[model samples]
Target: MHHTARKFSLSVTAILASLLVTLSPHTFAAVGSLDLTTSGIGYFSLVLFVIAYLLVMGEELLHLRKSKPVLVAAGIIWMLLGWVYTQEGMPHEAEHAFRHTLLEFAELMLFLLVAMTYINAMDERNVFDALRAWMIRKGFNYKTLFWLTGFLAFFISPIADNLTTALLMCAVIMKVGGEDKKFINICCINVVVAANAGGAFSPFGDITTLMVWQAGIIPFQDFFALFIPSLVNFGVPAVIMSFFIENKKPDALDEAVEMKRGAMRILALFLLTIVTAVSCHTFLHLPPVLGMMTGLGYLQFFGFFLRKTLPGSLARKRAIAESRGDQAALRRLGDVVPFDVFSKIARSEWDTLLFFYGVVMCVGGLGFMGYLALMSEVLYTGMGATVTNIILGVVSAVIDNIPVMFAVLTMQPDMSTGDWLLITLTAGVGGSMLSIGSAAGVALMGQARGMYTFIGHLKWAPVIALGYAASIAVHLWINADLFVK
Candidate 1:
């Protein structure tokens, strides 16, 4: 399946490349580059983008990595655009636009890299595993675990990211759910909603919010304003789903799992890193990536400390275990390994990071070609800010929010800070309405597989839609003051 998909992707790229080369010079002459948005090249570029995105959307079924299609599309789109500009005697414009887009991608890439590394480090240190084990040992009833996992997803996502939060909480649900498909379905839906909602109110939560923050559209502290609306979004669907959970408890497990040494310290360092990033951005007027990179340094040094102490730590643990005659302790101690920061960095989500690069560049290329201007005039100008922003949220459910938000940022629409926040909130939480809408949802579907399918999620879509609409209303009402110029 993988090889077939790769061959298919290469074939598509070759065909598109051939078409672009054959058509470019003639198309440029006919359209004359005066209005690239409606030019032959513009239409061709749009078609190429659509083809790329269609491949991206079909990633699950096609067994192809989402990054492949878009990366190829980006290269082809830019190559055509650059060729047109050179013919028009304006090569510098294309150069400047491409460089600007690259710069934007670089900042976002580095920021996400640091964040993913921290998440990977904590995973290595058994932080998430410990949390999972604790939840399983508690043996909470289905209803209690339902709300517990949902609430944890909400709060944790603002810091840990919705995708990771959902995956972790879904693990707990799958363990406790056993053979109950009903329980798995409802709980998975709840986690997706809660994780997305939680992320809506924090800059660190979702990529959309992070983009809004990095673009200077909203201040970091101002994001907390969405907390109530975000809570309402999760709460509405959760209340509806709670009654569906059976009032039974899973059998308890006696497994005792312990975190590796330095887990707590690594967790603390992550928090400190977040603080450092926020401070540098807020107080020092520096890019937040600078602070995040610095935080990576902290982890590196701490990892060095752990590596240096591992031999002695192991010796002491062996001595204590031998004295106490605890074979289990000695056996566990044997499993202890040196913590390598570089290994954690390597394990970060390279696919997602690379996908971001593709989306950024592709959207950036379209914006450079004038699609964003056309879009802005039609969406924000023709429809009004409030209606347009709300529509954007719905749009996010089908198309990934990263490109949608990137296009919006590139368009640089004129609107109040409140309107900006509205778009940010909508884009962040809107993906909850569908099973494939958000990363959290898509991930949970995979994690819970046969038990939690798209059809199962669709059954609850109306309920999720209610929460989506309610969230918008709550945002408009609660943040009314910001909307007033």
Candidate 2:
């Protein structure tokens, strides 16, 4: 099934490329050197983009990877734009724009790769498993665990991505809640809300915020101004739902787990890496990825140290086992183990990286064709920034926030810093309104399966909506000075 889908995507992309090539010269110069936005090719490009996004939205039902269709769409869209630019004697314009978008994706991809490697390394060393075991051993009642998990998700997501934070918290929910579906369902909702809300205030917290930060529209420290509003967004929904959780204790099993050697060091290295990335961007004025790549070197050297010492450590253990005449222990020590940093890199999320590539290129292509300018005129200029930004938050609840945020950035509307921050907060937290809205919410649905279904999340939409509105109101009131300038 997967192979067939791959072939279909490739075939569609090839057909589109060929069709563009075969179009009459008249179609290329339809308006006699007019703007591409009003030309025949522009309309065709829009149709192609719409079809590609429809496929992206239907990924769950279609049983196809979301990246495949968008990858194909991006290629075809750019190919057509390239042809038009070449015909107009401005090929460099197209080439430069394409390269610029690729650069953006490159920085994002490398930054995420280093972060994911550290996360994978920590996971492999039983760091997360140990944390899970500790929580379970606490044997807290359902209500206490509910608040505890929710608050943890809220705080942890600012450091880790919201998706990862949600997955970890969900694991605790499933383990502790056991067969009590109600406890599991409500807790999952709280995690999603808290994670999304927590991510809104930090550039590292969400992809949308990262983009805004990279674009130089907002400074790093200014993001913290949203901290109060973000808390309100998460706390409102959590306080309302806390009443629904039954006061009961889950059955506990005693399981003691220890983190493998170097787990703590790797975690510390990750924190240092984040600081390096921020410092490089803020002080050195270098691309943050440069610092991230440097941090990757730190891991590589530490991994080498662990590998170099393994045999000596294993030999000493084997010697002790032999003296005790414990044959099983001696045999187990015979297998030497070493940490390999490359393995962690290899385990990073390639699908997500590629999806980002497609989104950036496809949106760049549309912006080049003048669609985004038209959108800016209608949405930002016509509707005004404040109203348009609020509507965008609601729209994000239906569509994925990545594309919506990307398209807005491409528009480059003239708005105040407060407006920029408002959009950032909305785009990040708005996904909490629907299970399918944000990556964290979608992942939790899969992790929790039947207990956290779309309908189940939808039933609480009104309550979540309340938090959403409350957040916006608080932002407008508390940060009123930002808008004045």
Candidate 3:
């Protein structure tokens, strides 16, 4: 079934590509050389982008990878720009645009790559499982567990990605809920909301916040200003939902799981890497990616040490065969384990990374084409700034916040620091309102499968909606000073 759907999607893409190429060559000219704001081509580019976006949003139904259409659209948009530049007899503009895109892509990609590598390495060492085991051993009641998982999701997501945090917490939910479907459903929503809300206050929390930080639009310290608001975002819904959770205790695990051989070490190293990244960004006045790459280096060195000391089965077997004395086993161990960094990298979420690639390029192409300027006019100028930003946040619940925030950044509307923070807050937490709104929410749905579906999440949308409004109101009321010129 999926195969057939993919084939159809490809066919559609091929048709679109053909249409793009078949367009009149004279449509762009060397004399005037069309810009993105040019009526026909600009509108066409926007339509193409919108179509690609819709396809991305319907990825599940279409059985298509969201990256495919966006990748195609990015290529077409750039080609259109290239044609315009070529016609204008000034191809340097296109070249410059390419350079700019490459610069941004490189930094963001490397940052994500290192972060993902650490996550993969931790997973390889069963770090998450060990944490889960510890949690289960506590044997907290369902109500306590619910609050615990939600609060953990909120606080932890600021450091770890929200999607991963959501999945981890959802595991706890399922383990505690057992066969109780309704309990599992509500807990999943709480986890999603907590994760999204928690992610709003830190630059490292959400992709949108990361973008804002990397863009130098918001200082790292300013992001912390959203903390109270984010807490309110999580708190409002949490308080309302708490009444429904029954005070049933969870079953205690019969056996506690031990951490893997180097799991604790790896976990410690991961924390160090985060600190290094933060220090570099805060003190060194460098891009955080630099710090992340440095962290990756630390992991590599530790991995090498582990390979020598903790070789895998094949090495141990080889050592056993060569062992004349007890020490012979240790000496021959270096050949087998091999410090598997490549494996960790290979296991990292390439799909999500590539999806990010397509998004950045598609949005960048739109910016190059002048659509963002129109967007600025329509969104910010036509409507009041605060209302527009708030609406965008709500829109982010349905559409991905990554692109919405990217578009706003590209438009570069003049607003106070507070306004930037507001947009960041909204974009970050807005996805909690819908299962499909945020990566964390969507991920929890999949992680919990039949027990926690989209419709199930929507049932609690009213509570989450209250959270959505409350968080914004708190931000407006408390953070109003920042918004003043």
Best TM-score goes to which candidate?
1
Write candidate 2's Cα lDDT for 1-485 as tens digits. 12222222222222211221111111111121235687788888888888888988887799888788889989998898788878888777777767666655655666666766777777767777787788999999999999999999889888766776777888888888888888899999999999999988987677777767766677778999999999999999899999998889877868677676788999898889878878887888776677778989999998998888887877887789888999977765554468988776665445555666676677778777878778889999999999999899989999887778778877778888899899999999999999999877877777788999899999999999999999999999999999876
lDDT of candidate 3 vs native?
0.74
Q: How many residue pairs clash in each candidate?
A: 0, 0, 2
What lDDT tens digits, residue by residue, belong to model 3 across residues 233-309? 99999999999999888778754554446777877887898788778877887877788789889999988887777
Worst 10 residues of 3 by lDDT: 21-30
Instruction: Score residue 371 of candidate 1 by CA lDDT.
Output: 79
TM-score of each candidate structure, all chains considered together:
0.92, 0.89, 0.86
Top-down TM-score ranking = 1, 2, 3
Candidates in order have lDDT scores of 0.78, 0.77, 0.74
Among these predictions, the greatest lDDT belongs to 1
Instruction: State how far residue 188 of model 3 sits from its true place (Å).
Output: 0.3
List model 1 lDDT by residue over 159-249, tens digit each: 8878778888988888878889989999999999999999888977877787778766688899898999999999999998898888997
Query: Model 2: runs farther than 4 Å from truth?
Result: 1-34, 315-336
